[model samples]
Target: GAGVSQTPSNKVTEKGKYVELRCDPISGHTALYWYRQSLGQGPEFLIYFQGTGAADDSGLPNDRFFAVRPEGSVSTLKIQRTERGDSAVYLCASSLIGHRGELFFGEGSRLTVL
Candidate 1:
């Protein structure tokens, strides 16, 4: 089966603009997660969804950041009023079930807010 996939590998946007990053998980994966990685830092958790419902969303910095996994296979991370500080690589990962299983991550969508 295919691994996770993210679209628009790179994105350049001006401050205050909005952007959407998409991720497609592997077949049969029920656990999906979103993470963000800034320069010189490890990827930080953003959101996690079990099936079609988000189970955890505490990592979202603010209301401006949101995500959805309506079909349990694909997810979209939406950013509103983006700022220069928001520039980073958004990563998506998927797993079969609980944390005990292996997590496969996408190459990541790099967003650069100028």
Candidate 2:
């Protein structure tokens, strides 16, 4: 019954800390996604999952970022050695199908790196 959900509504960290962002998608939805939004920009596609596997992960900027959807219902985004440039609103979304269905999006986790 729940829509997409994300944890740690806000986080502030030093530049070198590691962070893990979590998302819980709507039950039975097979498409889950992670996106990032910086300041005034629209959310940028980071990665997407169809069922239990990552279908697209090309949007990740570099090796510091990774995501997983092991059971097709929940996913996590991991960032290593975070930088001030990494500060942004990390959003999660889900749909019934891959990239074509109505997307249900989460409120997003705001990360601030100092």
Candidate 3:
């Protein structure tokens, strides 16, 4: 029963570069979600996937952000043309299903755009 995990717990990047963050969800969990949390703020939903298709991606900020969950397991968030405003903690969570279930979050990938 591996819990969700994220890599590069901290990342520092330039304002216009691209970066990719990885997440590994728990086994047997079919619902995966990505969220962003700025300092002193609650997590804001970014995207979610059920199986291989993105069930909800309404929270993605703009075209600069995108994510994919292939094989219904591991997921990755990709950011293009990063900006200082994009600096935040990107969190990944997963649950058995999308509903009122509780979401287990990873330590998060902290992105700092300079």
Candidate 4:
């Protein structure tokens, strides 16, 4: 892929349901990150993975949110016990290791929990 790719551009789920959003980054990029954006706010960092290990996950709101990068090229964000307040655009970005400034973003997967 020439750029980041996110699956299911829009997802609508009922409250208490579980959802998994996937991201496939550009080939060979090593750093991947997940962010969330609400109605009027900018993208908020959720997690970051360096290779197959999570380097930072402090931005995740709570235990219901989790993400994994198993092979270092693709990642999945899992949301458990979803709530109406969790509706937002989940953004995935990637860049070459040590080149955070060159980040590339995917068309976020918009999660609408009703």
User: RMSD of candidate 4 to the true fold?
Assistant: 1.0
Full-model lDDT for every candidate = 0.94, 0.92, 0.94, 0.93
Error of 3 at 71 (Å): 0.7
**TM-score for candidate 3, residues paired by index:** 0.97
lDDT of 3 by residue, 3-53 (tens): 888998999999999999999999888999999999999999999999889
lDDT of 4 by residue, 43-105 (tens): 999999989888999999999999998887799999999999999999999988634468899
Poorest 10 consecutive residues by lDDT, candidate 4:
94-103
**Candidate 1 ranges beyond 4 A from true positions:** none
Clashing pairs in 1: none
Please give the ranking of all candidate structures by lDDT, highest first, separated by commas: 1, 3, 4, 2
For model 1 the local lDDT of residue 18 reads: 93
Could you give candidate 2's per-residue lDDT for residues 1-114 as a string of tens digits?
Answer: 567889988999999999999999899999998999998999999999999888899999999999988877889999999999999999999998878888899999999999
For candidate 1, the TM-score is 0.97
Q: What TM-score do all the candidates reach, one by one?
A: 0.97, 0.96, 0.97, 0.96
Q: State residue 53's C-alpha deviation in candidate 1, in Å.
A: 0.6
